[model samples]
Target: MSESSGEKTEQPTQKKLDDARKKGQVAKSQDLVSAALLVGSMGIVFLLTGNFIGGQIVGLTQKSIQQAATFRGELDMATAGDVLLEGLTTLALTLAPLFLVVFILAALVGYIQVGALFSTEALKPDMNRLNPFTAFQQKFFKSRTYIEFAKTILKLVIATGIASYTILGSRHMLPSLARVSPAETSQFILAQIVELGLAVAICFVALGALDFFLQKFLHIQDLKMTKQEVKEEWKEQEGDPHIKAERRALHMELLNEASAQAVRESDVVLVNPTHVAVALRYDRKTMQAPQITAKGADLIAAQIRKVAQEAGVPIKRDVALARALYELEVNSEIPENLYEAIAIVLRWAYTVAETHPRS
Candidate 1:
């Protein structure tokens, strides 16, 4: 039974594809490194900006506290609310533009690493992807995903623990902070900021490194090709051997058919038996010399002669001319060197055939 249209056809396997799957194409490590640098730079900018903003806020709050104690004026809650509102409004106006600039810079830096081409094909839903078995196979069965999940958990635990430690450590310094002079307090805050920043930076750097490796592993896994897909690609690119042989055979058959047609329509067949055959046609008004219509050897030569006999076309038995024409003038004008000789033979034959007028 013939295969249905929708059924998949088998094709030749390519070793190149197998090799590619085993050693997947390498991702640009430079891009990932650039991305990491951009992320770390953004973190540094956020840390510096946040610290500066917090220091300004604390200074304003402290001034308000001092004014409340020293001034003999009535404690107006409405005035306090107005001052607080103005402070918040000023902060919002100043920091909104700064945050916008930082965000745009960070986005541009990330784009420089990953490029700007947004591939929406990756977002398209696939029925195969929704299968529970396939999902399970990818998440748990795949070593890459299993490792990524573990790394993610480790990163979360480490970052949270480090951040918690920094906050707790700040509490230890807070009690003595009230007793110190303003200059000393400021110096101690600066020291604490540096310590916390260093801790956060170190923790995130380790997590980023793990994320980078996990990303690389996932990319390589995704690029892997199945055996069947590799075979189909080979068939599409480099044709199947069996199909190629069949096409070659069909091409030869068509050539034979064309040769047969030329033979049957020819005016005369000149032959050196199986070795040579040349079919010639001449029209006195249309052509200055006889044109060779077809030529071939062995079985084809015999077929040409047989067709010429059935069509009542002349058969000249000149071994030298037949062999020469077959070798040099197959489907072309007869050579200038042999034209005079051929004219003489044709004139003589015409005379003989005209006088006899065979019944």
Candidate 2:
């Protein structure tokens, strides 16, 4: 038995999911994409800084400052514009690779989560969204809202702890930085930044994974169908069974009526003793071969025999021919393979007719 109207017991069908997707409803996590972008950007930064890229940036900075210093005495609109352009070009060169890496990673993460999807249905305005009461219920009354709140709090606490721990661990090394050479101090700072960034990225990824699963769970829950909805959908897809059964009953009634009429007009009735009966008719000027005028089994076979007897049609007991014709439809021509067998039955019927003519 199906569940009650209020109970959502059925999983969403493929058609249901496809319709939802067309309306821009899909399982995805913004947090996962954010995490991937952050991690990817940080990794790019770390790799660039560890290589000659970092030295190139330092050299560019020094050269810019030297140019600015040289222009101090003769600074003009033209000289300022040139200096600005040089600085902007250097900045673009420094950040372009990191930006590309982050963009690619974000796009890949989005694809993996939801595939390719574009729908304008989500952009359409709904008056329900303007209702304060409905908005309040969605935000506060929903269980998912509470789960999201808990996740936010947990992420804040974890991020704070990680940052605090990293700062405290580096506190001892901070004082020694002033005692070390300038190059050593710079390397130490860069190393600490990398360490902190890596730790934070790992935390984001862990939270993102949990959020992705939570999003999928909520998506499936939202798609569950009630019993009534399932029935309506099934009817739309496969048609109503009650209507189909009625049509079948009408078809059988018409077929039986036609068989009864054929039995009355048959030339000969062939019987499988008691189980089967077939009535055949042949007209030399009309029909090229003998055709079964009626066929039936069991109770219907009894009816065929009675109709044949009342019409004064000749009846012959031939089990093989009777069974074979019983398998054919009314008014169907007998197969060539059964020609000899049916010919024998016709001869016997003709002999009987001559011996006892009908009044």
Candidate 3:
């Protein structure tokens, strides 16, 4: 069956996954980034700027009041402009650290989830997104819409539970707030606010992790292929001409090496004097007949002759014996029909080996 017509039963191929990634299709949960940013920004505010912000606000209030008090009349445009510029400048300077925290945390969270991915494919406009029918089906007819709804419910329940518990714990301090000094009251309120923020942030992290895993699972499922697709991909890869050529070259190289080694180990190389060469080895202790260790023609025969000369193995020129032995494969024993002829050649080689006895 065609891949598109069949059910997706095979896991996704690496090529398919890589193509999806290049098109900016990835499993990502925005909730995870949001949760991390919320936690980071909250920590920066409470730890570094909790008192600094209040002090800056009070200073800006004093500056505005002084500007009005000095000119004791309806505010002139120039004076108001000066005060406004100062307020804006103060606000920017005061929140610079908070903005930096958010920027850094968001980038870090996104990188941890997707590594280093920069694709503009997602930014390209598509006409399919404009189709109302498609949009409607995606919103109301897809499983993802229900999944989002479930996530929302989970967040709401966790947040409400945290809020309720926090309120009950701080109930006894509510009435005493009026009697306490303003500074102490502010401190108490700040502590309660910090507690709530921390609890909410922690819950968000838990929910975000669950959401991330769910999205990753769905993404893989969506990319799964059918069996036909796997077969087609395999065929295309195996049939590539370049790959086949490489395989052939490697096979030839291995064969040439084996042929050269056999020539060096042969008991004697029987040659046709110029063109054909056949190397034979026999062990009366182990073999009943002589074995053809190597054979070659033309350039390879020259190579085998060269290896035989270097290894001190004797070379004999015999047209009939070399021609007949060359027809057999290397490593095969000579047929019984040729044993008498081979025995004469081997007997002469042994006599030469014993007489010339080189160290």
| TM-score for candidate 3, residues paired by index | 0.65
lDDT of each: 0.64, 0.83, 0.84
What does candidate 2's lDDT look like per residue over 1-359, in tens digits? 54743788888988799999999899998889988987987787687677577877788889988988986688999988988898889878877877887899999999999999999997999998999999999999999889878888987898889889999998988888878899898788778778888898889998898889889889999999988887789677646687567545644663557876777677799998787988999877999899988777755677778777877789999887788788888778989998898888888878877887765
Over 118-234, each residue of candidate 1 has an lDDT whose tens digit, in order, gives 444556677979899998887888876667567668756865787678778778778998898997887676666666656655665555555656565555555555556655665
TM-score of each: 0.40, 0.63, 0.65
lDDT of 2 at 26: 92
Q: How well does candidate 2 match the true structure in TM-score terms?
A: 0.63
CA displacement after TM-score superposition, residue 220 of candidate 3 (Å): 0.7
Give a tens-digit lDDT track for model 3, residues 1-359. 55568989788988889999999888898889989987986686575436677788778878888877988787889878988998889878877877887899889988988899999998999988999999999899988899999988988898899989999999998999999898788778777777887899988998888889988998899899889888888688669897678655644763657876776777899999877989999988998889998887765677678878887788899999899999998889999999899889989888888887634
Top TM-score model: 3
Over 4 Å off, model 1: 1-86, 101-109, 122-138, 156-175, 181-194, 206-210, 238-359
**Whose TM-score is higher: candidate 1's or candidate 3's?**
3
Q: On a 0 to 100 scale, what is the lDDT of residue 83 in model 1?
A: 71
Q: lDDT, candidate 1, residue 280?
A: 78
User: Is candidate 2 or 3 superior in TM-score?
Assistant: 3
**C-alpha RMSD of each candidate structure in angstroms:** 19.2, 16.0, 15.5
